[model samples]
Target chain A: MAFSLLHGVHVPHRKNTRDMAAVRMDAPKTVVIPMSMHIGAPAKPVVKVGDTVKVGTLIAEAGGFVSAPIHASVSGKVTKITDYLLSNGTTVPAVVIESDGEMTPDETIAPPVVDSRDTLLEAIKRSGVVGLGGAGFPTHVKFSVDLGRIEYLVVNCAECEPYVTSDTRTMLDRVDDMKTALVAMKTHFGIRNIVVGIESNKKAAIKSMMGLMNEVVATGECTFTVKVLPSVYPQGGEKVLIYHTVGRVVPVGKLPIDVGCIAVNCTTLAAIGAYLKTGMPLVEKCVTVDGGCVKEPGNVIVPVGTAMSEVFEFCGGLTEAPDKVIYGGPMMGITVPDTSAPILKNTNAILALSKKETKLPKTTPCIRCGRCLNTCPFGLSPAAIARAYDKRDTVALDKLGVQACMECGCCSFVCPANRPLVQTNKLAKVLLKEEKAKEDAKA
Target chain B: MNTQLKLSVSPHIHSGRSTRRIMLDVLIALLPATAAGAVIFGLRSLLVVAVTVAACVGFEALFSLIAKKPIPVGDLSAAVTGLLLALNLPANIPLWQCVVGSLFAIVVVKGLFGGLGANPVNPAITARVFMLVAFATLTKAAFPTIVDTASSATPLAAEKATSLTDLLLGLHGGAIGETCAAALLLGGVYLLVRRVITWHVPVAFIGTVFLTSFIMEGMDATAALAAILSGGLLIGAIFMATDYVTSPATPWGKIIFGLGASLITFLIRYFGSYPEGVSFAILFMNILTPYISSWTRRRIFGMGGSKA
Candidate 1:
C-alpha cells in the first residue's frame, strides 16, 4: 500500500535537444492523418474525397465520450479516405489530405465559451487533445473526473524516458499556456493541491516553471509546488507520478481519480490552453528528433499526420540507414513499421537508431540475477511471471500480478542475460486475459 | 513495410552486461585466491587448478558437440567451475583425478541438467562433495604427509585446531584455496565491489555462522573466528553459497538461505561425522532455493499480501 520512491531504473537522459527550441516545419506535399490516434474509439470521418478543408477544420468527429475528434493540421483537399496501417500493425480508417502549401487556417475557428466545468471539459473534447506524452488517452476524460474525488492535479513533465524533450520545451517555451490551463482548472475544479512533477535532471524546465509558479496560484487559494523527482525512467508513469506526487497508491485495476489525483501530461495541458486562447484545435506537435543514427537532431514543431520520413528529413535525415525507427523513447517506444508512417497526435519523439543502438545480443538462459524483479518499479517478479506464462498457469500469473506490469521495460533494460522480460510480461497479461475470458464464458 | 527496420519488442536498449561478462568477472575475482592458494599449497596447487580448468572446459565443449548444441566454452563459466572445484580439492591430488572431478562437474552435474544456469545445485560444490565421497585419497589426505605443514591434519580435522592467527594467515594444512582466509577475503571484497554478488548472502551466511558458533561455544569469540577462518568456510560462504543459479534471487530469500545453511552446518560440524560442513550446507540450501524464492518474492504493487 506504500510507495517506494526509490524504485525504478536510472537511465541515460539523452536529452540532446534540451537546448534546441522547436522549429515549425513547412507543410509537406500531403499528409495521412489517422482516425484512431487516441485510446478508445476511432474518430468517424466527416470528410470525403475531394472535399476542401482548412487548418483546424474538423475532419472527423469523436466516436464516443471517450474518443477525441480529429482536425486538419494543414489547409488542403481531402485526397482520399481509406484504411491506414498503424505502426502497431493495426489497420484504421485515415483521412489523407493534399496540402496547398499556403498553411491557411479555417475561417470558422474561434475559442469556445467555457463558463463551467462541463463546458471546460467540452472545450477540451473539441480541442482533440490527448496525452501528448505518448499514451494517447483523451485528456478530456481525465479532466472530467468527479469534482470531489479529484483532490490533487499533477502536471507530469517528468519526461523520464531517454532522448525525449518535447515536455521540456513545453515547460521552457509555453509558460503562459500552461499557466492559463492551471488557472482555468483551479477556477473550475476548485482543487486545493497542484503538484508539478518533473525530473531533477531537467533543471532548466524546473527553473523556468519556478520563476512563474506564483502566477497560477495567485488567482486562488492553492498549494502549488514543483516536486523535483529523481531522474529515473518511468517516473513519469501516471501511477508512479501520482504516488511520488500525492503519496497515494491508485489501487490495482483502478484509475488515478479513485486515488484523489489526476496526472496529465504537461504538453497535453499546454495544448488545451492554446486551444482555449487561439481556438485552433490540436494540430501541431513539437517532437524531439534524435537518436544514434541521426545526422542532426533537435526538436521540430511538425503538423500531425506528416510522414515520419519527412520529419526525419527535415531534422537533417539519418547519418546511416537506421535499422530501427522507434516512435518514442528507447525504453518503451514502439518501432515504426517504416519511415512513411505518419506521426500520431500522441507522438513526442521519433528515434532513428542504427544497428549499434538497436541490435540486441543473443539471449542466454536466465542467470536468476533478480535484476529484472529488483529493478521493477512495481516490485513484480517478471521471472516468476515468465515461468507461469511458460506453464500457462493463469492462477500463478494472476497471483504474481501480471496485470500490474506497465511495460516500462525496466526489467528488460537491466536484464544481464538480455531477456525480454517486459515483452514476456505483456504476453503473460494477454494469456491471463484469455484464460479469464474462458472462465467468464463457462460461468 | 521495411524489413530492415526491426519490429522487436519494447526496450530497444540494454545494459550490455552479458552472462559472459558476469562469468569473466567471477574469473577475475578468483585471481587473488588462486595466487594465495598457489603460494600456500606450493606449485602443485596451480597445476591442479590449470588441469581442472582445462578438463572442465574440454568436457563442456566435448559434451556440447556430442549433444549437437553450440559449444559454450567462450562464456568462461566452465572455467569458473573448474577453478572453484580445484580450490575445494587437496592441492596434492592427482591431475587425472582432477580431470575426473572436472568431468563430473561440467558434464554430468551441469551438462546433463540442461547446461549452465539450469543446474538445481552448484556443479562445482556438488562435484566437490561427489569427489570427497567417491575418492578415499581425498579423505586419507585430510592429514597430508608433507612435514613442512604446521599439523598432520587440517585445522578443523585435527583435535587441536590451529590458533586464530595461524588460521587467518593460512599457516596450516588444508585445501589449496580454503586455507588462505586473507586471500579469500580479498577476493570476496573484489567480488562485492564489482557487484558480481551482493552483501546479503555473504554477510548473512558468515554472520549466522559467527553468531551461532559464538553462542554454541559458550560465547567463545576466538573459537568462532577460527571456525570461519579454517576449512572451506570463507571460500564456501563467499563464493559457492552465492551462486546466482543455485541461490535464492530475492534479498530476503538469500538471508533465509544463509540462516538455513548455517543451521545445517552447525549440526554437521558439532555432531555429524564431517569436521567441516560448509559444502554440504550450501548444497542443501541450493536444493531449497526454489522454495525460498517462491516464499520471498517481492511484493507486487497494489497487491494485498506480504512477501508473496
Candidate 2:
C-alpha cells in the first residue's frame, strides 16, 4: 500500500557469478578458525595446539548466551593457537588446524525424540544451528519465543543487494532442503502461516521454489505460499521485507517477532534442513568470489575459516592490482584493508574491484537535494539528519530518528553531492550515545 | 611480500569514480558551446574566455596554496564559471574586465560561499550581474557584426522586431555566444543526452518565457516573437538557469522557477528600466531555490501520520 519515492539510482548489479557455473573447492591444507565470528562475545577455544579434532567437532565453545559455537570442517590436528586477522580486519584468537583431508566424523548428539510435551526450545538448543545468512545469531535464541498467539513465519528469500547470489543459487539447487527446513521450523515452533518472500529479479529461483511448494501441496500438505516482491535494494532487511511481502511495518525499536512474525533468511533455512538431514554441524558455505578485478570470477563452495588468499588463488587470483577488496555485496558490505584477513562464518562474497571500476567520488557538500529522502525505504530524511549533524544539532537529529537509520548505504548511493550520509550518521550516533552517558554520570 | 595492509571492515569494494570525473564531464559537455562562441565572436571572444579561465583556475590554485587546503581546482568548477562568464559577455568587453568577472565569480561568489555544490547562486550569473551593475556603459555596449566597421545596437535595443531565422542563426547584435539560438539548442540537446541534467529547468524556463512574452506583446505577435528570441534568454534558459546545484530539486519547483523567471523578465522588459532582463530574472529565482526545495520536499515518513 505504501508508494516508493522517485529517482532511484540504476547502479550496475555486477552479479557476474550468479549464472556462471558454481564450483566446489578441495579441502584446504590448513584452516584458521577465528574465535569471534558472530555479533556477540568471542567464542572461547576448547582445543589446544597439537590436539586432534574431527569434522563436526566443537573446537570453540559459546562464550555467552548471545554467541554461537564453532565446529571443525575437516579432521585435523591443531598446529597453533594464536590471534589471527579476520576479513573484517580485527584480530581474534584462532585455532590453526592442519587438515588430514580424510574428514573424519565427530561425536554426535542423539536424535530428537518427539514428545508433544517436549518444548521446542530444548530441540533448537540441542541442534546448535544459528542463522547462516550474514548475521550469525544463535537460531535457538530466536526460536525460543513466547508463542501464545504467533502468526506470520516469514522466510526471507529476497537477495536484494546486488552481486551476492548464494541464497538464489541455493534455492535453485536445493529446494527440497529449503522446504523441509521450513516445515521443520513450522512444526518445531508451532507457527501456522509461513510466507517465502523472493525478489522477482531471480526468475529461475522463483520458479524452482514455486514448483517445490506445488509438490508439497499436491501431496495434500497445508497451505504455504511464496510471494514475489518487487526488486528493490535492501528489500532483504527484516523490516523492509516484512513491509514489501506482507503489508505490515515492524514498529520502531521492535523486532519482527514483536509483531507476531519471525523472519529468517532462505540460506539459513536451507542450512537448517541440511543440518537436520545429514546430522552435520554448520561448517562450509557457498560464497560468491566475483568482481571486475577477479581473473576467474565465480561462486565457490568453501569451508568456514578459509584464508582469503587461498580462495582468490582457487578463483585464479587478481586480473590486475585491485584497488579495493570487499567481503560481501557492495551495498551493505565492508571493505577489507588487509588481504590476509580470513573469511569466517557468514562470509558471503569476496569482491576485488579494479581502480577504474571501483572509484568513488570525493565527498562534497550536501546541496540539500533530498534525493536521500526519496530513496530511503524507512522514509527517514537522511539529508536533514546529515545537516543537523553538520552543526552537532542533536535535538534535530533525534527528532528525525537518526538512530533508526539501518546504515544500508542507500542514502549514500543516491546522493548526487556525494556526501557520506551513513558514515557521518554513524559518527553522530556514537557521539550522541557518549554525550548521554556523560550526562548520566554527571547526574 | 612483508607489506602488511591496514585491516578494515567487510565492504572492501569501491568504484573508481572521483570528483574529478564529474567535473570533467561538465567541462566536456560545455565544449561544443565554447567552440561555437569562439567561432562566432572571433579571437577576441576566445581571448576573453582564455583570460577568464586562467584567472579562475589561478585564483582557486592560489587560495588553496595560501590557505593550505587541497587544490580543488581539479574539480573544474572554476573553469565552468569561466566558460559561463565568457558566454554571458559581448565580444568587445576588455580582457581586464573578464579577469575581474572571473575573480569575483570564483573567489567571492564560489569560494567565499563554500566552493562548488555549496554556492547558493550560479557563480557565472552572479559575476555577470556584478559586472553589469559596476560598469554599466562598458558592459552594455553592443558589438554588431563589422561588415563595414559600423557599431549597431542589438535587436532588443529597440522595441521593434527581429526575424526568427536571424535569431536562430548568429546574425544579431548581442552577447558573444548567447546570440546563436541554434548553438544553444545544440548544447542543451547534448547535455540532455549525456544525462548531465534533467529537462525540468530548461523546458519550464523557455516555455514560461514564450508564453509570458506572447501575452505581454498583446496584439503584436512579431514583437512577442522578437522579445522571446532576442537578448540572452535562450542561453540563460538552457544553460545558466538550469545549473544543477542552483536550480530547484522538485519537478514542481522547477516549473515554478520557470514561471517566476519568465514573468519577471516579461515585466522588466515591458515596464522596467532595462531593455533586457534575462540575467536579473535568473538571479532572482536562484535566491528562491532553497524555499522551493523545502516546500516541495517529499514528506518525512511517519511524522505527520502513519500510512500503512
Candidate 3:
C-alpha cells in the first residue's frame, strides 16, 4: 500500500513484436550445443566426433550438484567436439551437430502410464530442468526439500522487465501446457495454494490464463488463481514479488524458499508441462529477438545452444551489425561477445541494439542529489557508497550497508548527473566483504 | 569475417537524457525573468545580459581548451551563470563590468571549481558577492523609476521606510532584477509549476523576513513589507539559492535553508553595513546545505514501519 522508495525508469515496452506475429521456430542447419549451460561447472562432452545423436538424448551429464545436463534438441550427426566461444566471451566445450532433417528424439522417459503426476520428481531431475527465469539454478534442488515449510507456490508470470515478452508469448500460445505444468507442480510440492502473478501490462496473457484457470477451477480439476500485479520493473524479482503477492519478505541474503514459498518463471513451468505430456527434455527455449537494430524483430522458439548467428539469420539477418548484443531483456540481460556464441538453456532474449541505443554519455561527478538513495530498492545509499569507494574509505563504505546492494542499476538509471554509482558500489561491496572476512579470520 | 559482440550488463537502450538536457531546461526557466529585465531596463539591460552570456560561454570554452579538458560548452551551465549574473547586476553597470562579472562567475566560481555540476557553490551568487566586494560603487548604482522618471533609491536603501506598494511593484529603483517584484514572482511561479523548484525555500524565506521584521520593528507595516520584498530576496531565494546541487535535498532541509537565509538577510541589512543581504544569506545557507540534508533525511523504508 505504500509507495516503493525506488521508482524504476519508464522505458519503451517493445512488446508489440509478440502481438504483431506468432512464435516462429527457427530451424537451423546445424545447432551449436554449448556444453556448459547452467550456473556452475562446465559440462564434459560424453559423445565423440562422428557420433549420431537424437533429440532428448543427453550429450553431457551434470558436471556437479549445481550444474544441469545438456541434451540434443535435434537428431543429427555429431560433427565435432571442440572448444567454442560462449555469449559471455569465454570459451567452453561445445557439441556441434548437423541436423539430418529427421527430427527424431533418441529416447524419452515415458510418463508414468499409470500416473504421470507421480513421476514429477524423477521427470524434473532427469529432464535436467533448471530455473528458466534467469538464475538458472537447478529446479530439482528446490523441490528436493523435505522441510515441509513451503506454503505457497507462486508462478512468476510477471515478465515485468521491458522489451521481454518470451514468457508472455509462451503463456499465450501454450495455455494447456501452462495449466498442466501448474498441476504437476502442485502435485509434486503437495501444496493446495497456488497463484500465478502476471503483471497488468500483459493484458492478453492475463486474459488467456484467467479464462483457462476459471474453467479448471469450476471443474474442480485443481485449485488455481491468477492475479494481475502492478506493472513495475524489478517486480519480477523473486523477493519483491513474494512481498507484493504474499505480503512477506524473505530474510536478507535469503531466498523465497526460506519464506515458505517457491516462485518459478512461467517459461520454466510451461517447459515442465510439455516434458510431462510429450516426455521431452528442455533442449530448446523461446527467445525474444527484438530491438532497434534488427530488421525483423520477434519472438522465436530456438534450440538451446544454437548459434546466435543462426537465430539472427532466421529473423531477417539483422539490418546492420548491432552495437551490442544482449542475451536477455534490456534491463538485466548480459551483453554477449560474439554472435557465434551459443544461446544457453536459460537465455530468454537476444536484443541486437544499434549504436544509438547503446551510446553511454561520459560520466560526470556526483551532485549528491540523493536521487540514488531515493530510488535504491534495497534502501542503501549508492551515491555515498560509490563516493566512499572512489575515495577508498572502507569504514564509510561499511557504515552505509554497501554490501547489501544488489547492483540492480536502478541508481544509475535515475541519476541525472550520470555518476558511475553502480560500478563503484560493486567495488565497495567486494572490498568491504573481503575486509569483513579477514577480520573474521583474525578473530 | 567473424565480428565479436561486446558483452556488458543490461539497460542497452539509454533514455537519451543527458547533462545537456538538464542545463538546457534551467536556461529555459530563467527566460521569463531575463525578458522581464530587458523590457523594464530597455536596451542597456539587453546588452548586459547578452554580453554576460557571451563572455561566460566564451570563457568556459577557452578555459577548457587551455586546460585540455573536454569542452562542455554545449552543456549550457555557462549560459545559466551569465544570465543569473546579469539578473543580479544593476542595469546601469558598464559592458566591461558585465564581462568581468561573467568571467568571475564562469571561469573562477564554475570552471576553476571543476566546471558545471562539480561547483560547490552557486556560481552566480558567488560571483555577485565577489563583485559586490570588489566594486561597491558600481554595484550600488541606482536608476530612475519607470513611472516618475525621478532618480530613486531602493526601499531597503531608505534611511526612512517607504510604502509597501513601492516595494511590491518595485517602482523604486534598485538592481536590474531586484526592482521588479512582480516579474520575479511571475518567473518563480512558472518555475514552481514546472517543478523546477519547491515552495519551501521561497515561501519560508519571504515569510521569515516579513515575520522577523514585524516582530523587531513592532508591526511598522511599511518597514515590514519592504523587508520582505526588498533587494535580491526574491531572485536569490527562488532561483540561485534553491539550486538542486547546492541546496538541501529534503523538504525540511529546504525550510531550514529558507529560514537561515531570511535570518541572515535581516541581520545584515538592519544591523550589518550592507543594504542588500540576499547574496550573503544564500552563500551562508549554501555552506550549511550538506549538514541540513544529513540532519533532515527521511527515515528509510521499514525503519518506521511495523517489522515483518
Candidate 4:
C-alpha cells in the first residue's frame, strides 16, 4: 500500500466508448487552429491570409527552442488570421482556413532516414509531436536531455480520468505502434527498463500491453513490464505514476527525468510511432465526445483544429440543452463558455454535460473534518492552505506547502462542505509564485 | 448557440455527502445508546432527550432569526448537540434544566460563535459543564438503583464496591446514556464503520485512561478495567471528544488531544474531589485544540527532511 499514501478519490469510469472503435471524422468546411497549442512559447504563423496549404504543411514554425511547430490538418485556403478564445478563457492567435474538399498531403510526408539517436530526436522534433496526454509539452525537448542518466522509460496508459477512453483505444487498437515505439526507445536510447503503467480496471489494456511486452522481450531488445495500479483519479499524473511504478519520488518543482524516469502518455507513444513510420506531423487527434447531453456518444478521430460544435453535430448533436461543455475529463477539465472552441493538440475529450452533472452544490462552512487533507494526493492540507491564501499570509502558505498541490481536484471533490479547495490551491500557487517573483526583483 | 454555459473551476462533480446527511448518520448511530438509556432510566429519560432536542433546535432557529442569518437547523447539528447534552445529564434531572442546558449549548456556545463549524468548544460538553456548575445538586442527584433501592452514589463514587459485570452491563447508577457500556460500544463500532469518526481519538483516550488507572491502582488490571467500564469514559471518548468542530483534524493532533484529556481526567479523578472528570477534561482539551492542530501539522508529501 505504498501507493495508498498517494491519496485520491475513485471517480466513476464512464468510459462508454471503451469498446467502440474510433471513426475518422470527415474534414470540416473550416478549421481554426491556435498557434499556441503546446506549453512553451507560441509558434509564429508563417502563412498569411489567402495562402493555399495542404494537410501536413507547416503553417506555424517553432517560436523558441522549447516550442513545437504546427501543421495544417486539412488542405485549405487560409480565410482569416485572428484571435480565438480557448476553453481556459485565454485568447491566442489562430489561423482559420476553408477546406477545398480535397485531402491533399504535403510533399514532405516521406518517412525520415533515421541513422542515429540525434536523427531520431530531430525527426521527433520535425514531426511536431507534443505530449498528447493533454499537457502538450514538446516531446523532442523531453527526449533531448542526457539519455545516459535515465533509468526507466514509463509509458502511461493509466487513463485514470473518467469519461475519457481515447488512451484505452490506443492500447487496444494500436498495440503494434506502441510496441514499435517502446522497442525503438530501448534499442536506440539504451534504456533497459521499459514499464507500461496501466490501471487494473482496464483488464483488456493490461492484457494487450502485457502481450506486447512479452513479444518485445522474446527479441531480447529490452526488459518490459506492466505495473498494474489500483484505479484512482490522477493515477496518470507524471509524478504520481513515476512514484508508483519506479518507487521514486519526484521532488517539488522537478521533472520526472530528475527521478531517472521519462514518462510519456500511451497515445503520445503511438503518435510518435506513426510519425516514425510516415513522417506526418501531429495534425489530428482522437477526441472522446460523450456526456449527458450527447445523443450518440463515442470516440471520433478529428483534425486538431475541428470546432467542438462540428464534432458534436457529427455525433448527432445535443439531446437537450447543455449547461457545460468541458474540454477534458470531468475531474480536471476546463468548462468552455460554448461549443465553438476548436480542439487543440491536447484536447482528448469534449464533454457537453447537462445541468444535472454541472450543477454546483450550496457551499457550507468548513467543519474541520480533515477529509480534504486525507484525500489530497500531494499530502498538502488544502483547508489550511485556503485559509492562509484567504488571509494573504505568504509565510503561512509557504509553510503549508501550497506549491505542492497538483490542482487534481481530489480535495474539492471529497470536501463535504463544497469549499472549492482546488480553486483555492490554484490561487495559492499563483500567490506563491508572485511572492517569489517579488523577492527575486528585490534581490 | 447557448452562450451562457455554466462555468466554474475543475471537479464538475461532488461526493453529494451533505452536512445534513452526516448529521443524520450520527443520529442513527446513537440510536442504540438512546434506546438503552430509555430502558434503564424509564420513560422520563426519553422526555428529557425529546425536550432537549426541541429546545436546542428552537434556540438555534430563534438566534438565526434575531441575527438575520440563514436558519441552519435543517443540518441537524442542533439535534446532535441536544442528544449529546441529554446523554450527559443525570437520568433523574428535571426537564426544565435540560431546556436551559440546550439554550446554553445552542444560542450561547454554538450560534453566537458563527454557528456549527465555527464553534471553538464542543457545545454539548460546555453546556454539560455549565449545568453541572449551575445545578450541582441536580446533576449529582442519586441514580435509582437497579434493585429498587435508593442509591445516591454513582458507580464511580462506589468504585471498589461495584462489580465489573454490573458496570459492563450498565446495571448500576450513572448518567442517562453513559451507564450503558454495551450500547455505547455498539454505537462506537457503528460510527467507526461509517467513518463518521476516526479511531485515533477514541483509541488514544481510552488507552491512556486504562494505562494510567492501572498504574495508579498498583498495576491492578481489574481495577483499571472497572475504572474504564464505569463512569462516562465510553460516551465521552466515542461521541463528545470526537466532535468534529472542537477536535483536532490531523492524526498526530488527535493523539495529542486524547493524551492530554486522559491525563487531566486521571489527575482529577485520582486527586481532586470529583469522582468523575471526563467532561471537564474534554472541555479543557477543546480549549487547546487549535494550538495542538497547528503544532502537529502533517508533513507534506515528498517533503521528507526538507525545511518548512
Residue range with the least summed lDDT across 10 consecutive positions in model 4 chain B: B144-153
Off by over 4 Å in 3: A1-5, A85-91, A112-119, A212-227, A437-443, B4-7, B65-68, B138-141, B149-153, B156-172, B178-230, B250-276, B296-308
Candidate No. with top TM-score: 1
Judged by lDDT against the true structure, how good is candidate 1?
0.87
Candidate 1 residue spans exceeding 4 A from truth: A1-3, B1-3, B140-147, B150-153, B159-165, B305-308
Cα lDDT tens digits, model 1, A1-443, are 45458378888788889999999998988999999998998999999999999999999999998899999999989999888987667899999999999999999999889888888888998999998989899998887767888889899989999999999999999999998788888887777888999899999999988865888767768989998989988899888888788787777788988878888899998999999898999999999999987888999999999998898889887788888999889998988768888878999999998888765667888888888888888889898788788998999988899999899999888887787789999999889889999999999
Candidate 2 CAPRI category: acceptable
Point out the higher-scoring one by DockQ: 2 or 4: 4
lDDT of each: 0.87, 0.73, 0.75, 0.86
DockQ-superior candidate, 2 or 3: 3
Q: What is the TM-score of each candidate against the true structure?
A: 0.96, 0.86, 0.88, 0.95
Residue lDDT tens for model 3, A1-443: 55342344555566757684445564567888877677777777788889888888888988876677888888888997888765556788889999887778776545533244346776776677788888788776677666367787888888866777888888788888877776666555666667788888888889998876775465453567787877766678776677777766666656677778888888888887888788778988888888777778888888786888888887888887788888887767788767876777898888888887777765765655666675666667787677678788889876676766666677777676677777677778779889889899999
Candidate 2 chain A: 10-residue stretch with minimal lDDT: A3-12
Report how far residue A344 has shifted in candidate 2, in Å.
Answer: 2.0
Kindly list the interface RMSD, in angstroms, of each predicted candidate in the order they appear: 2.9, 4.1, 3.3, 2.8
Interface RMSD of 3: 3.3
Q: How far is A428's C-alpha from truth in model 3 (Å)?
A: 3.6
Candidate 1 colliding pairs? none
RMSD of each: 2.1, 4.0, 3.8, 2.3
lDDT of 4 by residue, B227-253 (tens): 888788999999999998999988888
CAPRI-style class, candidate 1? medium
